[model samples]
Target: MSHADLLPADVPVQLIDPDGRVTASADALPSPEALLRAHEALVIGRRINDQAYALVRQGRLAVYPSSHGQEACEVAATLVLEQQDWLFPTYRDTVSIVSRGVDPVEVLVLLKGDWHSGYDPVATKVAPQATPLATQLLHAVGVAHAATLRGEDTVVMAMCGDGATSEGDFHEALNFAAVFKAPVVFFVQNNEFAISVPLARQSVAPSLAHKGVGYGVRGQRVDGNDVAALLSVLGAAVEAARSGEGPQLVEAHTYRMQAHTNADDATRYRTDDDVEAWRSRDPLLRSAAYLTAQGLLTDDRVAEMDEKAEQVAAAMRAGLMADVQPDPQELFQHVYAEPTPQLREQAAFLAEELSREDAV
Candidate 1:
C-alpha cells in the first residue's frame, strides 16, 4: 500500500501566513525578543545561501542547490535541535549543516568536489549531507532505533525534500520508525516544486504532514517561511522525541525561489510572475519586518549585520579559492580498517600520480 493509504483528517496548521500575519499563536511561539536574537543566525544563513549562489555563478561550486527563499526552514531546523541531537541533512541543506556548528568553508568541501562529505560527522553529530534522495531517512531511523534500544536519550532529525517523500526508502524509514516508536523527527521542507514537478502534481493528499498518520505518527504543518512557526513546531517535536515519544513528521510549507540547482532552469516550468509574488513573502524580509516593528532591529543594526554578512561571504570566497590540498590517501583511509587489495592498488596509483606531478 502507498504511504498515504490511511491519511489523517485534514487540518491546516499555520502560525503565520504569507502576509506576515499570525493565523494562530501558541504559548510555545517564539517571542519577539527570541526572534530578534535568532535573526542573526538567520541572516548569516541567508547571506551564505546568496554567497553560495554567487559561487555557482563564478564556477567555484560544481553544483549548489541554493536554499535561497527557504532560509527560515534552514535556520529554525538548526536552532530547534539541542547539541546532543543528531541532524541529518540533504544535499541542499548547507545552511542548516553549517549552522549546526560546522565550519562554513568546510561544508562546501563536498560541493567543491574535494571530498564526499565535508565535515567530521562523528564530531558534528550530523550525518553528511545525503546526496541520494531519502537515504538518510533510513540512516536517521536506524540511529534513533539503536539509541532507543540502548536507552539513550538521543533524538534524530532527518530532513528531506518534497520529492523524497515519494521514495521507497522514505516509506520504509517512516514505517519502521513508527513501529519502533523511535525517538526521531522527520522534517520535510516542502519547498513547493520537487526539482521541476510542482506540489500539485506531486500528491493529491490533503497535506504532506498527513502522511504521518498512515504510519501511526503525529504530524504538523507550518509556514516554512515563518521562522517563529518553524521554531515552535520543531521545538515541540524535538521535545516530544527527546521525552520518548515516537517518530513525528513536520511539513513546512515553503516555496523554492530558485532553480533546483545551478544546473536546472526554474523558468522552464514556472513563470517569473509566480516567483515575483513570493518575493514579497521572502523569509528574511518577513522576519525583518516583524523585528523592526518590535524595535529590536534598528536600521543601524541591520546595516551592521548586512555589512558583516558581506565580510563573511568574502571570507568564504577566499577560503574556497585557497590552495589547501587534501591527502590523496583520504579516499582509502576511512573506507575500511584494512584496505582491500583493489582499494590499495587504487590508492597507490593516486599517490604515484600525485608524486609524479609534484616531481615536475
Candidate 2:
C-alpha cells in the first residue's frame, strides 16, 4: 500500500490550528513539556536568523536567507532526528542545521564568502548548504540508499522549498527512494513564495505534498507554523522511514514574512497586506500563547526566554565578527582527489600572490 493511502486528499492534515488548539485527535499531540521546548527552539532560531539578516545589511555577511517565519519547521525537523541521522539542507535552512548543534560561525561560513563547507560533513552528518536547488535531494537519496544496502538504520531528511520541487533532480531522487525503499524524508517548506514567484506560478499541482504519490512514497501536509503539529508529524515520519517504509514527503504550508534574502525585495511581488495576514499566525506567537494558557510560561518566564534569545543573538554576532584567515591553497582542496595540471597551475598562481603579500 502507498504510505499516504490513508491520508485524506484536499485537506492538509494539521494537528494544531492557528489558535494552538488540537484540531486532530489528542493521541498524536506532543506532550506539553515537548511543546514548550519546541517553542523555545523556534524562538531562538528566529532570533539568530534575524541577527544574521542584520549582519548581512551591515556588510558582514554577503547574504543570508532569513528563516524568520519558518522557524517552527526548522526547529522541529532538527529535533526529531537521531544523532546518527543525516540532514541535507538548502541555503535557506541554516537554521535547521544550526539546531543540530553545529557551530554557529562554521554554519555561516559559506554566507561569509568562504568557498568550501565550514564543517566536516562526515563528522556532523549534515551536508553543506546546497545553493543549487534540489541538488542536495540527490545526495540525500544516495546516502539513504547506501545505508539501506549496508543494513544500517539511518533516516535522512532532505529539505527544500516549493520551487525546488520542479527540478529534475527532485523527481529522480524521490523516484529512486521509492524504488529502493530508501529511508529518506523529503520536507518541502512551502513558504508561499520561492524568491519572487508565488506557488501559484510554480506548479499547478493540487498540493506539493502529492508529488510523492507519483513515486510511490507517502505524503503529508501540515501547517508549517504549528510547532506541535510539525514535531508530531515529522517525528512519526522519521520513525516510519527508519522501519523500511520508504521515502516520505511533507509539504509545510507557510509564509515567508521577510524578503527572499537580504538582497531581494519581497514587496515588489507581494503586498504588505499579504504578509500582515500571516503575522497573526506567526509560529512563536501561537506557541507562546498555548504555553502560557497551559501555565507553562508566566510573564516572568517569557522575559527569561527573551533574554536567552538575546544572548544567542549576541554570541552569533561575536562569532561572525571573529575572522580566520583561510588557507590560500584550500581553494584546490576538494576539487579533485588529485589536482589536475590546470588546477595546480591556478593554485600556484594564487600561492605566489599570497606569498608576495606576506613578504610585504
Candidate 3:
C-alpha cells in the first residue's frame, strides 16, 4: 500500500536477475570450470534439502527447516569463503555447512536428535547450529574480534534469519562488531517470514540492510535467490573485512517456500497463492534457467543429475532405516568427562532397572 510496504527497490549490484539474465560485473568472473563446480554444488545442495524434507515426513528426522529455495544463499556464501574462514550458522544452515566441506551424513546428525552431529568447532571452524535465535551473531563477533586482536586476516561470517534481527542479541552483536571493527559479515537471509511472522511484522525498518547503519556497520541488500549476486556481495564483504575495512551486514532478500519447520504448518497462516508467488522465483529454477540459456545444461545432464540425486537420497533413507538407536545409557556416559557421583548413581540405577527387566 506504500513505498515501504512494497519490496525494497532492487539494486544493480546484483549480477543475476530473476529472468535468468546475467548482468555485467566489474569483478572478474570465476573460470568456466569453477562455475561448473558452483553449479554442481547447487545441485547437491538442493537434493540435500529435498531429502531432508522427505526424511521429516518419514519421521527419520526429528525436525527440519527446509532450505529448498535458499541454495544460492548457501552456495554463494561458501564460494567466497576461504577454508580457514569461520562460519556461524543457524539450524537451516546445513546446506552452507555441507558446502563448507561437512559430510552430508554428519550434517544430518543434529536433525536426528543426536548431539554427536555437532562437529568439532576447532576442527571445522563451523560452530554448531545456534538454535536460540540470533545468538550465533555474538559468537561470530567474538571469534572475529579474537582474530582481529591477533592481527589475523581471517573473516567470520554469521548467518541468521529475518526473525533473529528482532532479538536483543542481534543488536548487541552488531554494536560490538562496529565498536571493535571486527572482521565479521552479518549475513541475514530475509526470507519474508520468520516462522509465521511476516517481515512486515518483524521490523518496521523497511529493509534489514538499513539496520547496519545504526551500528556503524556497512550494509547491502542483495538478491538472495541470485547465486552470482550472493557470490559477488559475499566476496567483497570478506575481502573488505580481511583488509581491515571492518564489518558488513548483508541482507539477502529471498523467500521460504516451505514451512518454518517440519512441525510447522504454513496453511494455518498463509495461503497457497503466497507460496506459489515465491515459487516463480525459486533459486534452483533460476539457476537452472541461467545454465540452460548459456548452453551449460542439457537434457542428458539434467537426467544424470536427477539419477545421482535420487540414488543418494535412497542411500540416505536406507542408512536411516538401519541406524541403531543409541543405547539409553549413552546419555549418562557423555554427560561428564569424569562422571559426577550423582550422575554415576543415576547411570547405575538405569542399568540395574534394565537388567531386572531383562531377567523378568
Candidate 4:
C-alpha cells in the first residue's frame, strides 16, 4: 500500500461532539452494552484520577500524573482489549491498569514507592508501568514478536503520551513492528504536552498518527475525549492487528487538564483559559450525556455508578493508609537466579547493619 493510503484522516474521527451530540453515523459504534460499560468505566476512571490526585496531596503517593481529562482514552482502550491480550502502560496510565482488572491498590504501589511493580506481570499480562518515556513501547513490541514466533494469538497494546512519540525508542519500536508485522497497537494519548513541552514543538507532522506511514503502519486519529469514538476506533485497530494486518498507530487528540504531575505547576506553561476550554469536553461528562440520551444511563444507573466509584476510592484510600514494612532483603532476591559474590556480600552487609541497629 502507498504511504499516503496509510495516513490518518486530515481530521480526527469523532463520533460524538463536546455537547454530547452524535455527529457521525452510529452504525460503527459499539453495542449498547459496550457503550454503557464504557460510560460506567469513564465514571470510575475519573474517580480514580481524583482519588490519586488527592493521595499525592496527602503524601501517600510519591507523585501522580493525573489523566483527568483523558478518561475516554483509558476506558475505551481497556474495554477494547480481550482477556488474552496484553497491555503495556506508561506511568500515566494508572486508570487503564485498574480497568484491566489489576487490584486498584496494587496499581498504585509503584507510585506509593512500595515495590518495583506491585502485581504479578505474568498473571496480569501487564508489564510494570514504565516511568521512562517510550521504553514500554519496545517491550510491547518484543512481546508481540515473541508471541508471533510461538504461534500464539496474542495482541499487545502499548500506551504512551505524545511526548513519548518524540523518543528514539518510539521510532525504533514502530519501525521494528512494521518490518515484522507484529500484532501490536501503539496508542498515543496526545494530551498536547510532554510534561512542559507542547506537541507543536515535538513534531511537524500533521498528526502523530501520520508518523506511522513512514514505517508501513496504518494510522488513525480519534477524538480522545469522545469515548464512543475511541471505542469504535480502538476496537477496529485492535481487531485489525489481531487478524494479521500488522501494527497500527492510533493518535487520540486529548488534553492534559492538570499539571504534568503533582510536582509541576501547570500555570507556568499553560493558562487557566486553556484548561477551562478542555473542561467542557470532559470525557466523563460527554460519555454520561451520550449514554443518557440513549436511555442507557438512567438516574438509578448514575447512582449505582457513583456508589461503585466511591467504594473504589474508599478502598484505595484505606489501602494507602495502611503501613507497609518492606523487607530490605527483597532488593537482592530478584536480581539473579544465583546471587553473584558481590550481591551476596551486599545482602550480608545490609543484614548485619539491620541487626546492629536492632541491638542498639
Candidate 5:
C-alpha cells in the first residue's frame, strides 16, 4: 500500500477521539470485549504504577517511573505483537510487558533491586528494561536482523520515549534497520518530556514520526491516549514488519500524568495545571468511557476491576517489601556468574564488618 493508502491524509492517524468517539479504523480494531479488557489492564497498570510510587516513598524501591497516562499506548501497542515476536522495552513499559504476558511479580523483582528478577529472554521474548534511553532500539534491530538471516518469522517491537528520538542510538538503530530491511517497529511514546526537559527543547522537529523519513522508513503519529487508534496503527506496523517490508516508526502522542520518577520533582519544572490538562485526556478514562458507551462497562464492573487491581497490587507490594530488608549476603551472590577477585574481597570485607558488629 502507498503511504496515502493506510491513513487519512488529514486526520493524523486517529481512530478514537479524546471524548470516546470512533472513526473509520476504530471499528476495524479490537472487539468491545477486548477494549474492556484493555481498560481493565490500564486500571491494573495504573495501580502498579501507583504502588511502585508508594513503595518508593516508603524506601522500598530505589526509583519508579509513572506510566499513568500512557496505558493505552502500552497495552494497545503490545496487542499487535505475535507470540513469536520479541519486545525491547524501557523502564516505562511495565504495562506493555504485563499485557504481553510477563508476570507482574517478576517485573517487580527488577524494580526492587533483585538480579534474579531479570527476565530470561528465552522464556519471555522480552528484554530486561533498558534504563539508559534508546539503547534497546539497537538491540531490537540486531534481533530482527538475526531473525531475517535465520529465515525466522519473528519480528521485534522496540519501545522508547519521545526524548529517546534525540539519542544517537535511535538514529543508528533506524539507519541499520532501514538499510538491512530488519523486521522491527520502533514505538515511541511521546509523553511530552525527557525527565524535566520539555518536548520543544528535545527536538526541533514538529513531530517525532518525521525522524523515520531521514532513515527511509515508514513513520506515523497516533493518538496515544486512544486505545483503538494505538491498536490499529500498531497492527498495521506489525504486519508491515513481519511481511519483510522493513521497519516502521510509530510515535504515540500522549502525556505523562505524574512525575518522571519517584526521585523526580515534576512540580519544579511543570505546573499542576499542565498535568491536570493531560489527565483530562487520560487513557484509562478514555477507555472506560468507550466501554461505557458500548454498554460493556458499568459502575459495578469498574468497582470490581478497581478492587481486583488493588488486591493484586497490595499483594505485590507486600512481597516486594518482604524482600527489601536486604540480605547482606546477597551482595556476594550475583556480582558475577562467579565472583571476581576484587568483588570477592569486598564481599569478605563486608562480611567481616557485619560479624564484628554482631560480636559487639
Candidate 6:
C-alpha cells in the first residue's frame, strides 16, 4: 500500500455523531447483535469506572486511573480479541482487563496494592497491566513475534494512552513489529492528554494514527465515544493483523472525564466547560441511542443492562470493602525459585515475629 493509504482519514471515522444521528455509512458498523453486546459492555464498563473511583475515595485502592469517557475504547479493544489472542494493557486499562473475562476484584489487585498482576496471564492471555508508559508495546511485539515463530495464530493487542506515543519504546515496538510482520495491533486511546500534557504538546503529527506510516504499518482512526464505530474499526484492525497484514495502529479520539487519578486536581489543568462538553458525548449514552434507533435496544433491555451493571458494582464494592490479611512471609516465596539465604532469613524473622504475637 502507498504511504497515503496507511494514513488515517483527515477526520476520524465517526459513524454516529454526538447527537446520536448516523453521520456515516453503516457498511463499517458491526452486526446488530455485536452492537448490542457492545452497548451492554459500555454500561458495565462505566459502572466499573464509577465503582473504582468510589473505592479510591474509600481508601480501598491506592490509586485508580478512571477511563470514564473512554469506555468505548476499552470495551472494543477487549471484544475484538479471540480467546487465544493476547492483550497488553496499561495501568489505566482496568476496565479493559475486567471486560476480558477477569474477575473485577482480581483486576484491582494492582491498584489495591496487594499483588503485581491480579489474574493469571497464561490463563487469561492478558499481560500484567504495565504502569510505565509504552513498555507494554515492546512486550506485545515480542510476544507477537514469538507466536509467529512458533506458528501460533495468536494476535496481540497492545494498548496505550496518547502520551505513550511520545516514548521511544512506542516507535521501537512499531518498527520491530512492522519489520517482522508480527500480528499485533497498537491501539492508542488519544483521550487528548497524557495526564496533564495536552495532545498539542505531545506531537504535532496530523493524528496519532499517522505515526504508523513511518513504520509501514496501516493506520486508522475512530470516534472513541461511539461504541459502534470503535467495535467496527478495532474488529477490522485485529482481523487484518491476524490475516498477515502486519501491525495496525488505531487512534481513538476520546476524552478522560475525571482527574487522572484520585491524587489529581483536574481543575488545575482543565476547565469544567471542557469536562461538561465531553460528558454530553458520553460513550454509554451514544451507544444506547444508536442501539435504540436500531430497535435492538428496548426499554426492557436497557433496564436489564442497568440492573446487571449495578450488581457488578455492588459486588466490586463488597469485595474491596472486605479487609485483606496478607501473609508477610508469602512475599519471599515468589522472589526466587530457590530461596536465597537473605530471603530465607527475612522469612524466618517474620515468621518468628508472628509466632511471638500468637503466643501473646
Report lDDT per candidate. 0.85, 0.88, 0.82, 0.92, 0.84, 0.91
Count of residue pairs whose backbone atoms collide, per candidate: 0, 0, 0, 0, 0, 0
Better of 2 and 3 by lDDT: 2
Per-residue lDDT tens digits for candidate 2, residues 1-360, read 845492425766677777866677888888978887888788788888889988887778999998888999999999999999999999999889888988778898789988878898999999999999999999999999999888887999999999899899999999999998899999999998879988899898789987787778888888889988889889989999998888888988888889998889888999989999999889998898778767888888777778988988888789888877777687787889988999999999998998999899
lDDT: which candidate is best? 4
Select the stronger candidate by lDDT from 1 and 3: 1
Candidate 4, residues 123-178: lDDT per residue as tens digits?
99999999999999999999999999999999999999999998999999999999
Candidate 5 per-residue lDDT over residues 203-284, each given as its tens digit: 8875788788777888888888988878778888999999889999888889988888877888999998888777678878
TM-scores for every predicted model: 0.91, 0.94, 0.90, 0.98, 0.89, 0.97
lDDT of 3: 0.82
lDDT of 6 at 34: 87
Candidate 3's error at 61, in angstroms?
1.2
Displacement of residue 4 (Cα, Å) in model 2 is: 7.1
lDDT of 6 by residue, 1-360 (tens): 787789788888888888788887777677888888888888999999998988988999999999999999999999989999999999899889888989889889788998668789999999998989999999999999999999999999999999999999999999999999999999999998888999999999899999999999999988999888888889999999999989999999999999998999989888999989888899888878877887889989989999999999999999888998887777887788899999988889989999999999
TM-score of predicted structure 5:
0.89
The residue ranges of model 5 lying beyond 4 angstroms of the native Cα positions read 1-11, 324-360
Sort order, TM-score high to low: 4, 6, 2, 1, 3, 5
Error of 6 at 189 (Å): 0.4
- Which has the greatest TM-score? 4
User: lDDT per residue, candidate 3, 1-360, as tens digits?
Assistant: 232422333562567567777776535455555555667778888898888888878888888998888888987788788878999999898889888987666778788888675477778888888889998899999999998788777899999999999999999999999899899999999888889898898788858988887777878888898787777778888998888888888999888888889789899889999888888787777777877888888899888877866766776687664576579888787777899999989999999999999899
Error of 2 at 250 (Å): 0.8
Reference-based lDDT, residue 215, model 5: 77
